[model samples]
Target chain A: MDRGTRITFLAMVALLVAAPYVLYPVFLMKVLCFALFACAFNLLVGYVGLLSFGHAAFFGSAGYVTAYTVKMWGLPPELGILLGAVTGAALGLVIGWLAIRRQGIYFAMITLALSQIVFFYAVQAPWTGGEDGIQSVPRGHLFGVVDLQRPLGMYYTVLALFLAGFLLVYRIIHSPFGQVLKAIRENEPRTVSLGYETDRYKLLAFVLSAMLAGVAGGTKSLVFQLASLTDVQWQMSGEVVLMTLVGGLGTIFGPVVGAAVIVTMQNYLAEFGSWVTIIQGFIFVVCVLTFRRGIVGEIMGRFGPKGAAPTGGGH
Target chain B: MFELLGIPPQALFGQLLIGLINGAFYAMLSLGLAVIFGLLNIINFTHGAQYMMGAFVAYLSLTHLGLAYWWALLLAPIAVGLFGILLERTMLHRLYKLDHLYGLLLTFGLALIVEGFFRNQYGSSGLPYSIPAELRGGYNLGFMFLPTYRAWVVVASVIVCFGTWFVIERTKLGAYLRAATENPTLVQAFGVNVPRMVTLTYGFGVALAAFAGVMAAPIYQVSPLMGANLIIVVFAVVVIGGMGSILGAIVTGFGLGVIEGLTKVFYPEASNTVIFVIMAIVLTIKPAGLFGRAT
Candidate 1:
């Protein structure tokens, strides 16, 4: 990472650690979960150039699985989360395999159509608890030692997972596989002619992205102690898209910043009621029309990639 | 008195009628989407919201201005289409050269804003739009009671769909539009104002949605949430129809609506999901969509 990106990431870690004390820990956890979710989504859209509009299928399904395992099966927290990730990977395998056959807009539509199917299943399926959703899920003991019932304990667990996922994304983006994925995004035909199996790379990235999203969803279920249709709805998928777009597509830490801004905005604007959606809509229009580079991207653009501005720059 | 596949004729015909009505809306909306996508290459996510807006505009005009249904029918679509034109000029025009997904996101946000504002102002509880006086009652046919309003909606949609198709496929104006879609720069070289053509095309597409919205206001409650859910179903229809040709969108829209209606009659549990299931099967069998040419 560049100097600016490094400092920014560290600062975020410090701020996230201290946030629960000053702010509501639950709210902090929610932001972290969403930030991670946006990052996972960005892995496909930003890096792979595949905009999957139905990501909520993975995110929501994982949430349900984790909730069910912890609440009904009484599984350990780690195992429940693991199951959630596996569930997401499995779903990603099916969806990504089918979606990769088409390019661009068709891929998006197919993912959306497939995700709707998942939503319908969740609605009718008994395990999801129908409209009520799975509720009162036990946070359980974190690794058999940490009492997750405590806010700080839960905060740390979520923080660790977020960092791990974030680092994994960073590593993947910089790796050779990541370069191939980027190549696919930039130009698929060229990548294929160069002997790269572009579809396989896209599929792998999609599955990995889904798995990470599942981690966020599963953790969210434990953190909020609930899983419902809200998590799996197209609205949630749209929110991730908004977060990623606002932060900057194809950037590593942009999603985290975007998530923070959006979550903060929603928190402050909670009293404003429905105006939040309107404001978000306005922001989207503005961003697409003018600020396509997003907050971090703009900062990086002006500073020549040095990450000079501590507050606005990448690092 | 006889049964076909153990289903009563009355029930089958009832579901079929309901299906046809749904198909009408689907055909109109998807037809609009296909047109916009063809020239603009942007999926109008706000199409649903615009449809909702059309209904609301009609409602507002009727309640506030003492306008009749006929007047609102003419005015609502024009009003919504004007907004669409303005949106294209101000916001959408900027993204014409960039990734199309940006347009989708921008429109999605717009949808949220429109829906949110409506929800806040009107609340989620849908208000009823009275059926027009001319099409108020149902005609008791031999097998089923056919409401005149519903019948009008289906017929009107079919007529509108065909009219659009004919305009695009037959007229000299349509030839220019098609040529523009294939190569806007080339069409511009031919002395046609392609950019202005694009703006007008978007307006026309959105107007179709507005027309459907006005039609739907009576059948479904005029509510903020109406378009959000309907758009997803329409998206499924668009996928099944393949977004290729105008006729395909119309046929798929109506066919899927009928299928959904049948599902409601036979297995209400699957009614809501049957369209999506069909989309999945289509993707598995012909990933390009039924009417869509392989890209």
Candidate 2:
């Protein structure tokens, strides 16, 4: 809402609008999907003070839903994506309900376990095609109007979706409900004493986060025209966490930057095979040990919000 | 000729025994995890990698050091435990003052690095580690056949689990450890070296995982990816048992293993997920876990 921050966000948007012409469309779309995923993840970890380690369950499952609907049922891309988002929210409800029973570290562990359960289901479920995943998923017509097979057509759709998601998150962050959520994050017991049901607020935030991540995953399946077990795996969950952490835990623009940095790194390092895992681990160690503030968070510390902490401000 | 639920006794017992063996490793690994968490106040995420290290060390000892099964039983845990000490003193020691979750994140990174390096050198295919000559072959209990090595795993794990319980629940050293876990500063004021105790607790916990890994090498293929899959299940077990109580971990580990084995008989598809389903129910009914004290 600050003038400087608004201007910065506008400039970033302007750049994104123009980037498809300069860069590869597929790569940019990939970045957009991940940026959105990281943003959804940050909504919980950064704002709600809940570290969920199994977000890929939502993201990956969304991809599967979209892919299955579009490919098997011949649904249009828009419908498929919507179904995916709904699936993510529903899965989120079940998972968030279970996960919110615990706080802090236990919350993370529960989500991870629940996600593992989902992963096992994905592996064994016939519809998911197991390891091969749902492949060659037709891009389908965009609501039976726009042909998404055209790279530019898909790029614009993704851009429009990304901006909508970005603005929705912005609105949520500034809303009164968001303020209540922040209070719960800062002090749940005190928030409850203030006549607020902290658990409901936390659950709502978790669902919203899962829904948006589902959107990203569903969109990603469209872009790539496939959905696979790789999307549902624990490592995918870890990658999203890393993206959010590296960019900035609580900042609005942090996840976007973090996702871009990570996706770019993966693209270039695709040649190195397992070195990717080692390098990611190295970054995690360095980030945890030396710079928990992260790239966006550190900058925000010096120049942006005064009391805003990257994670929940605590001892 | 006897059958129950359309499955022969031999088939059911075979699956149950296999489950018991798997549960043995789970019990040992989770016991180590509970010990470390109780003292260090951080979950050891690198445990899977440490378990993998145990098997790798065993393989290396046989091929390079010219040592055999018995020696690996003695040496691998020591070697891996020392490595755990080095890790604790160097990297993990610094994070004690921060949120314990940071310790989890740090160990996760460590797990990735350890698994990655092994993958680079060994590749993904599991290497063969034959059962020791003395333990080779089987015992016919008339109704069913039991592999001796598998039987040894179950017995050894039970004894080890019991030995750990006796030490912590009965002895003076364990009393000190419990005291330090409750109030390290007060224990330190009482002239105990709480810092040293913390370090050793972590090492011992890690050593327990490595020991289980050594035991697992012959039964399961010695592969880099082996620990990664098993560790997640152990984590689920830890969660179900609640991290606070040692006995909860052991009981849940073995019991879940049996339940999972029986699921394999009735509904093979659900076996991998049955423990998780039970975990979900446990969380709903008793979020503090079977033995964990409610906060």
Candidate 3:
């Protein structure tokens, strides 16, 4: 990593480690979970240039799976999370398989449509508890050892998970595979002419992104101790998009900052009811029209060397 | 008197009519989307919110302004269309040179603003819009009873949809539109004002959605949340039909609505999701959609 990025990363970690002592651990954990989710989403949109509007399917379905397995099946929290991630990857496989057949706007619409099916299923399925959702999920012991029921314990565990997911995303972006993904994003026809199976690469990136988003959702359900329809709603999908856009579309740290900003805003604006939606929508308009570089991207462009900034993933 | 597959004809026909009514809305909405996408190349994510606005305008005018349904039918589209023109001019026009996704995101944000504003003004609960006196009762056909309003919706939407299709497919204005879609610079060089055309096309599409919403206000609850879910279904219809053909969009919208209704009759559990399932099946077999050319 570059010197600036490394220092920024260390500072972020240090602040996160110390954050729970001052702020509510539950709220911080929520930010971390969303940060992870946004990072995963960035893998597709930022690097591969594939925008899947249906990411809530992976995130929420994973939440449901984690909730169900931990609460009903009596599985430990770790196992439940693993199962949730697996479910996410499985869903990504199916959704990505179908969605990659089309590109651009149609791809977004297809994913949205498919995810709506998941939303409907969640609504009707007997296990999801319909409107109430799978509630009162047990946090469960971490591998029969650590007591995650404690606030600090849960906070640290979530932080650890977030870091791991964050590093994995960083690694994926720098890898040869990631280069191919970027190449495809920049010019799919050229990448295909270079003998890369662009679809396979795109599909793999999608699955990985979905899997990480699942991890975030799974962790979130445990933190909240409930899995509800709110997680699976199309609005949830849009929220993540807003988070990613506001922070910075392609930057590694952008989604983290974005998630933190959005989550914090929601926390503060909880009392305002639908005004939050209006403000968020306003931000979306402003961002698309004027602030496409986003907070992190703009910062990087100003301070970093010429031509080195991500600048909203090359577009 | 007879039963088809052990189901009473009354029940079956009633559901079919309901499905057709739904299909009519779908046809109109998707037709609007297809038209907008064809020229603008941006999926109007705010299309749903615009639809909801149409219903709201219709409802509010009745209660607040004492404007009746007929006036709402006239004014709502004009009001919503003007709003769409404003959006296109101020916001959407700036994004024509960028990736189309920005347009989607911008519109999505606009949708949130509009939906949120309405939700703030009127709570999530639906406001009632009574059927007009001219179309309140039902027609007792030989096999079943069809609500007059519902029948009128089908007839109105069909006429509107075909009228749109005919104008686009056969008229001089449509020829210019088609040429512009293929090559805007060339069309512009041919002395046609293309930007004005784009703005009007967007306005017209938004107007069509409002028209559907107004038509739907009485039949369905004029709720803020109504268009949100319906828009997603229409998106599925768009995918299944593909954006290639205007007629395709109309047919797929209506066809899927009927199929959804059939699913409701046969398997009630799958009714809400039958269209999405069809989308999956269509993507598997024909990714370009039934009517879309492979891009």
Stretches of model 2 off by over 4 angstroms after superposition: A308-314
- The alpha-carbon deviation from the true structure for residue B151 of candidate 2, after best TM-score superposition, in angstroms, is 1.0
**Candidate 1 falls in which docking quality class?**
medium
Measured against the true two-chain complex, the DockQ scores of the candidates, in the order shown, are 0.55, 0.68, 0.78
Compose the digit string of candidate 2's lDDT tens values, residues A1-315: 879778988999899999988999999999999998988998898888898989999999999999999999999999999999999999999999998988877888889889998999999999999989999999978878889999999999998888888888888888999998878777899999999989999999999999999999999999999999999999999899889878877889989999999999999999999999999988888877877877888887787667654652335
Q: Which runs in model 1 stand beyond 4 Å of their true positions? A: A2-4, A306-315
Q: Model 2: which residue pairs collide?
A: none
Residue-wise lDDT of candidate 2 within B126-183, one digit each (tens)? Answer: 9999899999999999989999999999999999999998899899999999998899
Best by TM-score: 3
Q: Candidate 2 or 3, higher DockQ?
A: 3
- Which residue pairs clash in candidate 1? A4-A315, A5-A315, A8-A315, B23-B254
lDDT tens digits by residue: candidate 1, A130-208: 9999999999998899999999999999999999999999999999999899789878999999999888999999999
lDDT of each: 0.90, 0.90, 0.94
**Per-residue accuracy of model 3 over A60-86 as CA lDDT, tens digit each:** 999999999999999999999999999
TM-score of chain B, candidate 2?
Answer: 0.99
TM-scores, in order shown? Answer: 0.96, 0.98, 0.99
